[model samples]
Target chain A: MNVAKRNNVTVTGQRGAPVVMLAHGFGCDQNMWRLVVPALAEHFEVVLFDYVGAGRSDLSAWSEERYASLDGYARDVVEICRELDLRDVTFVGHSVSSMIGVLAAAREPGRFARLVLVTPSPRYIDDGDYRGGFSKADIEELLESLDANYLGWSATMAPLIMGNPDRPELGQELTNSFCATDPDVARVFAHATFLSDNRADLAAVAVPTLILECTQDFIAPREVGAYVHAAIPGSTLVTLDATGHCPQLSAPEATAQAILSFTGAAP
Target chain B: MCRTEQEQEPERAGGDGSLTQDAAFTALLEDSAVDLYENAPCGYLSTLLDGKIAKINSTLLAWLGYTREQVVGRMSFTDLLTVGGRLYHETHYAPLLRMRGEISGIAFDLRAADGSRLPVLVTSAVKTGTDGQPLLIRTSVFDARDRRAYESELLRARKEAEEARREAEEARLRAERERERLQNVLVTLQRSLLPPVLPEIPGLETSAHYHTASPDRLGGDFYDLFSLGDGRWGFFLGDVCGKGPAAAAMTSLTRYSLRAAAIHDPDPVTVLTTLNTVLLERYTGREPRFCTVVFGVLEPEGEGFTLTLASGGHPPALLLRAGGGAEYLPTPGGVLVGVLPHPPFTRTSTVLSPGDTVLMYTDGLTEARVDSGRALFGDGALLDFAARLAPATAKDTITAVTGLLHGFGDGLDDDTATMAFGVPASGAAGKPA
Candidate 1:
């Protein structure tokens, strides 16, 4: 098994510098970090990869039995790091991947040096006093929403959005290839991401951690971010001025600045 | 009349009439342009880069149950979406639009002012400025109530089809397993109708083979060699008519009846007569069962064997001579057993010298098709084949005949049974004669 090819791992930046591996959450691929990669690349060795079943990764490697839970995704991360022999790495995860990094770091503590969780949520559904920010019915409605947008990931609608005749150059880079995943794989990943409760996994994080939260995010509310920060001992929390759950796209500069400052790589 | 006269007076003043017509046409065109934008069938909107609603047509406002004052500059696009739709828009829709600069035909449900959900299909494009810099976004919304209903119906139908296909595959597998189990049972029953191993006579060598054409149906051919008593052996080979369970039942009765009769009376003719009586009494009905058999008694006579054979409509036995020749021991005038109460049976006697063998068989061998099913391997061919194997030992002859049967391949479509017995020559203990 070629782990790099299976996960679509892309390595860039100074070859010998400190490694910063970015793991994307559900719904999108490593292309979600396109805006933040340039700034991070100049100071450190930046690694980008799409989890199996997302982006241009080998989708055949995906199995419903393995990917039905977050453990399967964490295995993908562990294998990629082992394949590259990465050491003392800075792991940055967005959305649900924040907990995925916690799992990977706990499994192989020596491989990861620091962890950066962006708009993180350990759990999506609200518990009694924890307030993870959603109801059980809302998650069911989210699955319904995924079914309604089945055409959005289908080939028919992808070409319409990707093929820009007026701007032919834009069509070159964005060719029917953006978030188009297999519908079955997408459904399983949705179930894994929205229904999972990983609050217990946070206490096992022993590495230095930084939590980046957006000021106003509906998916991962500020309370959820505070919960994640308090759960992990000695973790730093920084709130960006961005509005949505994805600060890397909404505020790329601030997102990169916070990551570089935590790693002490910014000159 | 007064209106018609007044209308015609304007046309008479043609120079002024042209100016008046131009003014009315310009007024109509101006009114239509504004009306088309405000009252188009679909809704339209433009938003800033952050999705703040900058401009919205009246048609979309009416669909949302929001007035122009409440919508513009007050709520972003996500505010109009349902909770699930908002998460989808932020996580998937907006990210895709940011990467591709445009996205279309994405399904989302919008929350109206009264908290009702309205399913809609949205297409949005980024409006860049002259310097290729960032700008606002233009969007179009189409009501998708009917299309959503149709799509859900298609999804449900697809699920049902998959379920039906899985069930059909399971049924086919179950039927295959059942057929295998039945074939196993038939094979076990077929073995029970024959001797487990041929009895070893004092001064003779014997071998037998049975070829079944199909495993699914039980074959009716049976052969056995059993000791009667006082240095005498009773042997028989026969085939019951028809195939399957009915013929199989009759074959079982015929084999046991022949054995019991031989014990009572070792004479070949008497043993066959008793079997005939037993079959006729038990299976005489609308679908009458019958069989053809050759029963024989063999006893050692001065270093060789004297075989007394009786046939009831069965094919004659082949005798291979020690002097390199073969011929059938004819038993003429025999009628089929069990069909009549007093049917005549033919009886014959033959002396087997040193190294001479007698082979008895069912008609399935001689009747096998040959030459690509264009001809039958008849009695003449069997005689010729036996002549080639003349002066051969019993085991060698049976092996050669089994090879010949296999050579028929698919042409041999019936069950065949062959049994051979011979006395060894002087200087060749177990070698072929």
Candidate 2:
């Protein structure tokens, strides 16, 4: 565990660019941003770290009672930024961590200057007035698949969750990040990610936020991006041309440019 | 009245009887026709070939929200149909009626009193005079709302049943795929615990076989033969009690411990004792596990070999001699390996002469149930089997036994594992002859 942390994160490019903190979705750790790093690193300061029960972090530290809600993960993002004493931070999050970063930035508004959310979905289940694209039956299908096959579920569910597999190798490396964690940890995170609902917290985020929505993303539909834009007072909403859940891996250059533009950093 | 009396010429003269009767009958028929037309069970009407209303009944007028005078010479039959129905009648019903001189049982919708659609079945026939010239058309209409509703319901229920059947088929396919996946895992795991092929000992004729009753569930029987020390070898055959993943785990544990213990001490009896201790230590309390194992150490002597055999509540090994007879090797007072702290394991010595074979098997073979009477193949049957194949080599003996096991049909319910060893005659080593 110590050795993995000792291998310092590989940060490229000139150091003057604003440091961007990259956080991962559930069932994945920091390694998911590996493919996106080479493209963004040339113009930004990149920071990556594993959530406590993920990647190479110590597994003994995980407690069901503590990490039951995503608040525990949200605090860790804020703590990492505070430990480094970073300013004007641009926090980029994928899936559930998108809102995690939102909660963290809302707590310490001065620490982060901007937020970039990719394939962000605030709620997975449907509400009375909102359609999150998943039904109660669809969630049960996802649960059965998780119960049956955990090791290869990302591979099986990627094309379904991504909404487009014809391009191929979309999110393949990001899914490999899932394999690096223990299977048991992946199971717990899968439950936590799909069951969380945080639509109400979008209004609390005070940073200048830009949500990167894939036009045909099965995870977060275009309408959901509009919902986020509607709730977050002055947040910018931009739609990517790509059609998968993880457009960061599908079209990294476009995603990197969007993140750079949102932070007001010269790309 | 005065003119009628004068015109009534000669009321005498038999009174043209036939003519009076015809006049009275014709008057009665005309009255009945008018009554039936006004109160018929179904709507009845006649239209010209051009579809102009020439005659209509009271019932037909009431159904169409029109009075008899309003429709009798004003509207056409097609005007009473809905838009699509009118189009269908124009394109299909009119052309077919012209050719066939009649059309019947055509389903259609008609505009009703409240401007709502009333589903109806209609039959129309074109009338022709005796001169072969077309005249007016007679049409009959019946209410069909009940039948239409019933047909729609039946179609809906049939569609729902088909969807249910498709879902069941998909679930069955998923279940089959899951079973295949588990079987593949079990086969791979089962292979890992046993040797692909037994080690080729110089003077020993050895062969082993494992038969799985089900591919998806793992069998608890296992066997292996490997070199122990300088010219001394060790082999063991054992059967755990249960089935499924738990038994598979025990099989793996027993196999690894036997190999590890044999490497620690070359003695077969001591290795079996060590495995007993391991099993006792690991699974002694709740849900304790036990197996019946036979461990043997074969040492080379002069022309042939001698073996030291120990039994842990397992079946007695059978020895077949070259003299065309077989006997059971005695290892008495043995108990199951993991049940007690210090279970007594009995050891015995036996020599393999030229063309002599020894067989070891699990109880799955002998205890196989036969018929409804619950008769078992039993120890007697196995002994008889061995005696019948007295002069056979180890390979032939195993081949014969496996064939016999296959012949048990439905009797053999559990998995079977058998191991046999023999010493070839010095001259006939290469060929069966």
lDDT of 2: 0.75
Candidate whose DockQ is highest: 1
Candidate 2 residues B168-253, lDDT tens each? 99999999999898889999988887789988888788999888777877889999898986888888998987988888898889
| Predicted chain A of candidate 2: TM-score | 0.82
Minimum summed lDDT over a 10-residue window in model 2 chain A is located at A1-10
Q: Write the per-residue lDDT of candidate 2 for residues A1-267, one digit (tens) a residue.
A: 332232223345558678888887764456567667886787788888667666445455566665667887787777677666778988899878898888888778898888888878888778889888766555554433233223333434433323222333543544232333444555466556667788889888887889998866656789889998898889899998875466665556788888877765644
Model 1 agreement with the true structure over A1-267: per-residue lDDT tens digits: 988877878899889999999999888888899999999999999999888888767766889999999999999999999999999999999998988999899888899999999999998887889887788787777777777776335555433333222343532454335666667887899889988999999888899999999888989989898998999999999999988888998899999999999998873
Q: Considering the two chains of model 2, state its CAPRI-style docking category.
A: incorrect
DockQ of each: 0.58, 0.01
